[model samples]
Target: MNTSTSGTTKNYRVLLVGDEDNSARLILNTLHKVGLECRYAVGAAAGLSAFRENNIHLVLLDLSTPTAETLCARIRENSTKPLLMTTAATDHQVPLIGLKVGADDYLLKPLDPPMLIARVFALLRRVYVYGGDESHVAKAPPSYSDQGSRLPEGWATCEACNYMGPSPRFEGRSRHGQSVMVCPHCRVPAAVTYAVS
Candidate 1:
């Protein structure tokens, strides 16, 4: 488990969407036991309503819902939070469909409590716990130099994955298309700019 430092405590809110009574109860109990705040809705309309009205950190959905794809699309339209889909369907194409609709992960039913918690932790770590692009973009240090377009060679660290190593050979573009350098270890943007030293 990742521990937050002083002044970094976070309140993680999960929006769970599913109609299965037993599964929903288990998930709710497990998440609460682990100290995460969660809200549950039995249908797509209620789920979307809850999500829009609250600050949800993650979304857990049951693929068995008739409107799962549409709900996923609607949620993705507004939030970039991690979305996970779970189903007991044996059809091989179900997981693929979930991914296409913007699910970050798809899991089968009879979910393991430890693994479920771990996956949730991993998602939270990537998006909020660690210094990801979302948290560091605004606070990025100024560009090293303005005279040259070429990046300097040196050791760099990935704030997203906390990987310290030599930088990659090429610069990568951000989601907004700005050229940025990424860490060789985890491939997350290392710095928005670099300079020859």
Candidate 2:
């Protein structure tokens, strides 16, 4: 598990979106037992409704949830919180798509209960904390900070590798293109190409 301090003490409101009653209950139980605050919705609409009232810090979505992609898009437009998608054993692409849609992590099904728990903890920590990935980003010389090019608001920039992995973005338009962009240090590109995403 990636341990960090930023969000550790803050109470994060999490939205659990899934149709399976048993699985939701199990996850809810585990989170509560471990002392994490959360709210759960049975379907897509309900999940959005819950998000409307709660300051949700992260989302836990079942891969099979109806309207999953649309829901992800909606959430992506609104927040930069970490999204954790739950995928079944046969779905190899779920994780990939989840990230593309702005999910921060994914849990494979036939779920190893402990793994899911760890992911949630790590994600929440990152969202509220500044130092996990920022330790590297902060090391960058001020010259590296983009002045003309806009970065999606919170997208992290790694100074050591200069790789801007991922983060929440600013609203409306900015200097950044809002892609899953990489900084110059992630990997050197061929002279003909630019490291946009």
Candidate 3:
């Protein structure tokens, strides 16, 4: 899975919260294959502490952990970062409650590595790449904008045609709910910007 866009690879950090060390290791190995860095926490307290102390970009929570729900809710209160949950329980309500408490996605354990990787990538793309929330981007240094660029802050330079203008000039959304900016000059989806409230 090449997670790069526009020839740049994002160094996204993931936090794995669970008591199951073997499961956590498995997940870390899978994510590492695609260039994601991960941190592991054995319980809710440790998870919360790690989340606060580190520059975590996303979270993978094992719902079977006794305190998973509490950790999930607390993390949601602190940040809008994507949270993916996994559990072995077949009870549908377990996942339902997890979502209600703020998980972005849930999976059943005896986990499928491919599906897990896909979901992680999807959430990262939606929230960090195409979603374009300034809060998330602010943590990472500017990758596109550079000191030599004449474009003003909040302006976008089209990747396809070099059309430069305020982000609104290229504003639009994709059918999948991604916030995309289409280049008016070349009719290509060119950029993503934080939507002003």
Per-residue CA lDDT of candidate 2, range 1-197, in tens?
11112222335566788885687778777665444566888778887777767767678988688887778888889777788988784767767887788778888776766456557755654555433433312232111232223333344444443334333311122246553433343333221112234
Prediction 2 global C-alpha lDDT: 0.60
lDDT of 3 by residue, 1-197 (tens): 11211213456778888885677778888777656667888888888988898778889999988889999999989688999999998889999999999999998999877567657766776676566653544332222332132334566656543345567878777899887778765678834332232
Best by TM-score: 3
- Poorly placed runs, candidate 2 (over 4 Å): 1-10, 131-197
User: TM-scores of the models, in the given order?
Assistant: 0.63, 0.60, 0.64
lDDT of each: 0.66, 0.60, 0.71
- Stretch of 10 with least lDDT, candidate 2: 135-144
- How far is 107's C-alpha from truth in model 3 (Å)? 0.9
lDDT tens per residue, model 1, 1-197: 11111112234777789885788888887666555667888788888888888677788999988798899999999778889989898897998999998999978888977456656655665676453545522222211222122232453434454333334543577789997787654565644333346
Q: Give the worst 10-residue stretch by lDDT in candidate 3.
A: 1-10
Candidate 1 global Cα RMSD: 12.2
Clashes of 1: 0
Q: Is candidate 1 or candidate 2 better by lDDT?
A: 1
